[model samples]
Target chain A: MEKMTLSSKTREAQSPTEQWMRYLGFPGGILLFLLILYLPAGAGLSAGAQAGAASFALALVWWVTEPFPTYVTSLVLMFLLLVTRTSNAKAIMDVLGMEVIWLNLLAFILASMLVKTRLAKRMALWLVVRFGHKASWALLAFLVLQLVLAPLIPATAARCVMTLPLMIVVATIYGSTEATPNNFGKNMMLLNLACISVLSSITMTGSSANLIAVGLIQNMGGQRVYYMDWMRVGAPVAILTMVLMWILGQKLLFRMKPEEQVPQVEGGLELVKKQYELMGPLGFQEKKAIAIFGLVLFLWMTDIFHMRWFGVEISAPFAALLGAVIVLFPRWGILSWAEADIPWHLLIFSAGAYAGGLALDDTGAAEWGVRMLFGGMNLKGVPFGFTYTVVISVMMYSHLLTTSKTVRTLIMLPIIITLAKALGWSPMSLALPAALCIDWVVGLPISGKPNVIMFSTNQYSVGDNFKYGILTCTIGVVILVISGATWFHWLGITPSFWAVAP
Target chain B: MKTLRLTAFILLASVLAMAVDLPTYTVRLQAAPDGSGQGIATIALAGCTPGTFNLPLGFTAVQDLRVEEPASGIRLESSERNGMTQLKVTLPPDIPAKATLKVSFRLKQVFQIVKLKPGEKSTLPATSRTFKHAFVNTQEYLIGAYRVEFLFPDGLMAQAIREQLPKPAKNEVGPRVLLSKVDGHQAAILQFNKLQQGDDTSMIVELVPTRRSFGWLIAGLLLGGLYLFKFKDLVATKQP
Candidate 1:
């Protein structure tokens, strides 16, 4: 139902009904948030708890349909949750403090600074110059830049935000409207670049979901999946899937040829230099924020090596909040807390996510869902492969239906374990692959955090995102199924604990 | 008058959607006597524990239970009394010592599914057990004075040997013995002389507790709002 770009429908601006929806959504959202946040506070409240959880559906629905900023809605919900004594401020906040949410905000701020300084644009310009004039080569370079940037910037929306202007730059230099071959080449280079950049986030560092999983895993108090350790397994799988995505995109996408001459941007880097000059004499606080960000990265990197000495450790969320305070308080300078303006929606959605997960637990709906899918296998005597295939396929298909990657993982992991236990089949056959492949689920533009942020800009249409996403997810799913399992099997590395036990 | 009526209608609709009340009903179990020094027959629901309802009730469940040295003649019973439907169980005579039975049920009225939007779905999914999917703890069910009957072959008379028959050896697929009626057309029902485990068996039956849908209207509103907001992006074709 969503069209090509996010703003495809919003460009003309608000309508009468929209005005009413906005007003209604705000107060109504507050009311709904209250309902969701409260109502289950007393004892013997299973139904109430479940209803409280299910009411979150209304929050998302209202946010999407109404005129209010979604993040503001998130803030409202958080306050209500605490105010109603639905959960302690500490407990609700713990979910917000989960690494993924903070990492996303930190990354957004950094990307914002980069955009403000024109640093991202200059880099894009330099990149285009270095890998010039050849369709395949340009696409390849774009792919490389995306892969490199994804790790540094976990927010897909941030990447699109920082680089979209550059894309427009390239598209303008080549083809502003429709394209001839050269324009088509730039088109291929830029659009595919955006798509691949989004695709690259399947790895933990590149996206919020992976970090969320790591947080949950750590919170679950078992294997402390280090940033680098996650990268250890995640990087290779992500890279392989990305490479395959490029080949498929070029083959399935277009036949445009590269141009002969490169864009002469001898003077483009000046904008960044001018920005630094215009902003002038960076203050102690700016320097401090930068220092803290650096320290956070250092801690994130070193955490894996000395998980003991350096471990007990710092998370990206705490680090970002620390940076925000340092920038706001220390030796007043270029930036202040006012500038940080951390979007509360990120935290709100994260809380909603936490609450949604609780509801699934409360209702036993998730188990009921998967059991129905696999229930007949033990009775109807379905073939083991069919059973595995059905389970695996369902895991893959779930991406199309839902956007939250962790929710899919939560649902899939338990079902796979339960089904494997029932059918005497190996669990890794489902678990390992789903974890490795969950990021590859690109069916809709909004499937992951990056996709959600990308949609916010309205540069690309929903249809475009859906089309591109479905393409990558399909290709990525097949590649992971074959290469991922084969590679893991060959290395004698089990994808899951159950597989080893099974 | 029209405005008042409209407001009242709206208020009533909202109430119906949001209201939830405590469910009233009690779980009741039934039994009989059997031979091989014991007696047995199927346990049937005599009726609701208290006041009945007009509500439709039936349970469906599948479970894994293992019974040892079991003599058949066990029956799980379900029926209606007054206006409400009831759930009950019947046992067979001469249930060998240590015999056990496993039963699971899934209910229809209690089963529910509603569509969700991207924003509404949760990361930690719900663990749903269908009413048809539940576990019964038999060892927990057997206790004193609660008569469990075992149905024996040849319809024989009272043998103090009844207490001598080992508690129905748990043969799980619902404690086994072909559950055939012994003589006197009387199926030997095993009366629990004394429960090996606890007599109070707590079995959780999952039912569809809530039914509500919200995603579609939201999607419609989002699209409609977006369409209205970006009128320029959506151009009209002229009908020449």
Candidate 2:
């Protein structure tokens, strides 16, 4: 009784750190407001720099503390960008205005409905009964599905958001002994799903960042990497890597005997069936969710080939907003008045990230960074082909600091380009290194959006991620560096290892 | 042996720092009424050297300098400094597309020796700045600005004008980038924007420090600073 009373009293008194953290969320917003005001007017250093810095701090807070709703922070970031004039006000508010976001919205809505109705569990068990005789083969099928779909779907978060539910279903079927998945096999299975989707995105159409790289490369007057050519290289690399990942999984993590008897579960199957049946008739909400999802995909896939045919120049963002609108339609039920189901805070964080990159441009913060890089190399690494290796290695390791691939790409690509040419070398050397190297990050759910969404399933942990991710990335970087070197000479595309003359 | 080597190094360094004069000569021409298209550009070099010089194929040797020709392809083969070398070639009035008049670049070495001394400075007049895609904003820094300069004989009446081009503006000294024919001489300097930044001809700066060992640290830190400013926030989450 004394202990209970003591615990109750303790609950009534908050700790110092916790108390400070609670206020950290809102004060952070106001601190940024002050910082924005201090920036010099024309260049936007004071405001833009503050925005980038503030957004970064805010993101750290949200990621660690979870003080505010993720979507609200996303919205807060958008508001910050809007209020500070960091980005086009319209663009900032309507960032989700892209079609790809809609596809994601539609996809997520459907996935949510499927899970909420227990249809996902039913599907998982059904598939396991049909295919679980070989665990690796079942996992391979899931891996292949993600790879094929990633190019079409640009947003990793949306893809992971949809696929996480399915992954959980697989985890349930594979039958780990522990109630919580502290097992090696289950943990690796979760990571394999993410790694495959993340790596396969080398094609111009694969991810938004890839497209941005291609566009930037084209602008450089270099020959464009045709869609087919990109696929030729990307598809093979992805498939080979997938096989390698499977081998690693089986040998190091799984190590199950071939004769390990699979349980022929009559009761388990029956229970799943009964539970699915108890969910009863498909409600209006469930039917509407699937239909809205279908509509979203229809809009999303317009770019599969005939994009111009429909006069669709709208970016992936607007398409997302349009698809999200379906949620508001009277017939298809979704979040009520106060519950938009959007992670506004996370969006704000993303906007703030965007603002930060913009600030780098406006304040010449990026230029300042570039100056710092080549300031030392000026005397020794001349004729710059030698310096190329040094720059590539630095950029590769930069992933250790951040997981937002877009932010890294946005900030580094130009500075590296400028620095290379200054050293009497061509900018072409930086492209492959930039696109292929940033994927070196694979450690935690907080590391990539897909990893985060995968984490939302609450299955994997830090240890699981660190074990496979670090090793995989280390191997991945080494292979890519070699491949890049080989391809550099083989393609004979740039002036390096060769020269242009009259 | 060591003292000899040190003396040699000091001598070479001092020579590089000072002006070494080459031999010079003078040949004057009176425009005699028939010299309607004739002109001359000379300077005062107290101690300067004039070396091998010649006017090659593209230039029409105009002893009289009275013809009006049409050739923009003409380039000066012989670069004879005025005060440094006195026998100046006659220049054409209008150099047209096909006409072999005079301009410069892509000329073979010519042979002419006139004067020598060791103290006067014959200006080594050439400068180039890298034109590259350095800006981090839109990938379009190439379509911006370019500046070039040309020096003539008379410092007082000297004017720089550009013509027969796309976009022209007021240069600091010359007509910005667009120069039309001035005083009917085929001599001029031209500048235009490269197609885009990051193009093959784009200028990039390599901050090469003078000290050999220190340059690497400077470059690494520079690259790190850039990587940080540009990407510090991204990896900020990964930080402890």
Candidate 3:
């Protein structure tokens, strides 16, 4: 069994061709942008819309290839849009200040507080102590942590950041180091990446992408989707898929040895318990963090109550910002501004992507694209069942083209809503299912923020993630389709095949 | 007796034919704060004899109705038929070949706040409420340049605008005073130049954040102070 290690040497040893390809990605993106902009004026899109499309293509390329830092590409995208005059500066800045961006920022601050107070470590240790006797149980414990935190955290990247330290500790405890990796480390890290990305779709506020989709849906004149309604449709799919992921990881992909299955060291449990002891009892800061987080969770869950009675709507971002403010307040707060570990790069990237997306909508590029592609196809006459299958399939595989889930949601939901409107079908039926597939961005290492973060662990290679990811993604698609046809059909979200003439 | 009956039938047939040949009516409505408005509609009747003409006013109550004709005092009468108010006005018997009849009315328009989600049904106190959009039903006529002006309460500012139609031709933000009240407010006016007959329109105007959210800032500061004093070590120590 080979142990896992985080070595910088491995990353520096890229082949000459790989390096050249990385450098070529930027110009390639620029060329694609120009090609789209120079398309025949008769293509039926306004010049501004064409410019928006060009910038979007360029950003997608840069995000996937990482010729520069992902954040730098985001900056480049903003600069390009400004130079092209696709949208004004004020409009682009507004996109940056949207509630979705605020939610992510506040969640990052809260995550930093959790890490600083060592509360995250304490919780992780308690779970390890209870379930660390066996490798399978430890994996299940991590999965359970993700499931519990999914609804409350709101940011998949933040959840992954909080859980990564625990995962590394667990991997180390299992005799898995960088130099000598084992099946246990590989399965654990890969599963971590998958669970973090997939489970986010289970709640409306689980990720920024979900919120973006909801906002677009509401903006398009669809019925406002409530929190409970999202959970009712998403929880079953999420829970079932997570269980299947565990089974696939343990049984099919990585078979474990007897020694690896249990604690490899005689005093493995002792080491974890001693670490827990070193932290001592819960400090006042830990208690305060818990209290604030609890309040935030309560507000997020019961937003409907406030909205109905007080006529006050406390959005997820507002709730998270409340908690963060409480945690970082001077003298009373647990952390200072300097202590907070917010990832500005991710925020910048998201802001630029959002700006491009808004331009796509405001300039009518997405709508035009949809009309041009599907206008003459007469998709309205197609059976609803077939259309549902096709939309779900396209949404599932779309991760191959773009890396950011926010960008994917921005590009796809509007088009799907437009298509649904044209076809005389319910927008929610298409948009909701497509939105659920937002977090299936596990096909490549750079597919999602969490995936990128997990890749830094170096416990698993890109091939390991792709091989497992593709299989599970296929399984997920099947599960989603079957659910849409059967379970969701019973729930009236999708039309049953029996009801159709096909 | 047969000749008298034929004369009566001829007169009735002539009136029916004139009704069928009446030209289309075009109206321009301006919505104000507090959901009240006024509109002026022009009915063209070239090359046709003048008679009593009926115009339907969707579902709004008209406070006053009149016909604007020079040197003519034409009385206007209104009645409810099939859940709609129909305004009847009489034109001169010797109307010219290219004359236009203008009808105007003060509207006490009441728009329903569109409920997009199930949880939005509960009644709340007026002070804490913020409505995103209102729906106006315009299924009565082929409206031309139908405009709506949303006046937000004092201290509220417009943030964003969304409409179901292919983006509004003219969406401008300005200042306005609340109707029947002394409070000043911001106004967002959205214009739709042409609306197909029997189609309804909806608009959502998002508002800037109110001062109520400042409570969160204060709470955060208090909590931060308490943590800094009680658990200084935890705050000072950085995690690995």
Highest lDDT scorer: 3
Candidate 1 segments whose C-alpha is farther than 4 A from its true place: A1-103, A132-139, A145-237, A250-292, A303-312, A329-333, A336-367, A376-388, A484-502, B1-240
lDDT of each: 0.43, 0.43, 0.65
lDDT of 2 by residue, A181-203 (tens): 43433544555544544454556
Model 3 lDDT at residue A450: 72
Can you give the DockQ of every candidate in the order shown? 0.02, 0.02, 0.02
Off by over 4 Å in 2: A1-107, A116-119, A134-138, A172-193, A242-295, A304-307, A314-391, A397-411, A416-430, A438-452, A460-472, A491-502, B1-240
The true-versus-predicted C-alpha distance at residue A254 of model 1, in Å, is 7.5
**Can you tell me the CAPRI class of model 1?**
incorrect
TM-score per candidate for chain A alone: 0.60, 0.65, 0.74
- lDDT string for model 1 (A1-502, tens) is 0011212223222355545455455445445544553342211123323343435545554555444444544555555444322344576667666655666666555544434434444554555555645445656766676676666655454455445444544543333322222334333433544454445444665555556545544433223555555555556656766676566555655434333233423343354245335554555544544565565555544444545775565554555555445444546423444554344544465455454444443343343345456654552244443454455467766665444566666655555654554555454444545555556555543355555444444333334455556665566556555544556556443342223333
State model 1's lDDT. Answer: 0.43
Q: lDDT by residue for model 2 over B1-240, one digit each (tens)? A: 999999999867744543312121111111111212233322112222222113111122334332133233222333333222112222232322122222222111111122436886532112211111111111222323332322111111111110223333221111222212233321223344432423322112111111123342354356435544553333233335
lDDT per residue (tens digit) for residues A1-502 in model 3: 1122223323321345545445555566766776776564322344556667888887877665455655677788888778665777888778668765676678767766766777777876777788987889999988888888877666666567657656766776786656555788888888888888888888888877898888887777365888887888888887888889888898898887777776555566887788778889899988988888788777876776877866898777787878888888888888888777665666676677667766776665664454454455666577877777778877787775555677667667777887777777778878888888888888766566677566656566555777888877788878888888888778777766434322
Task: Pick out the ten consecutive residues of candidate 2 chain B with the lowest summed lDDT.
Answer: B128-137
Better of 1 and 3 by lDDT: 3
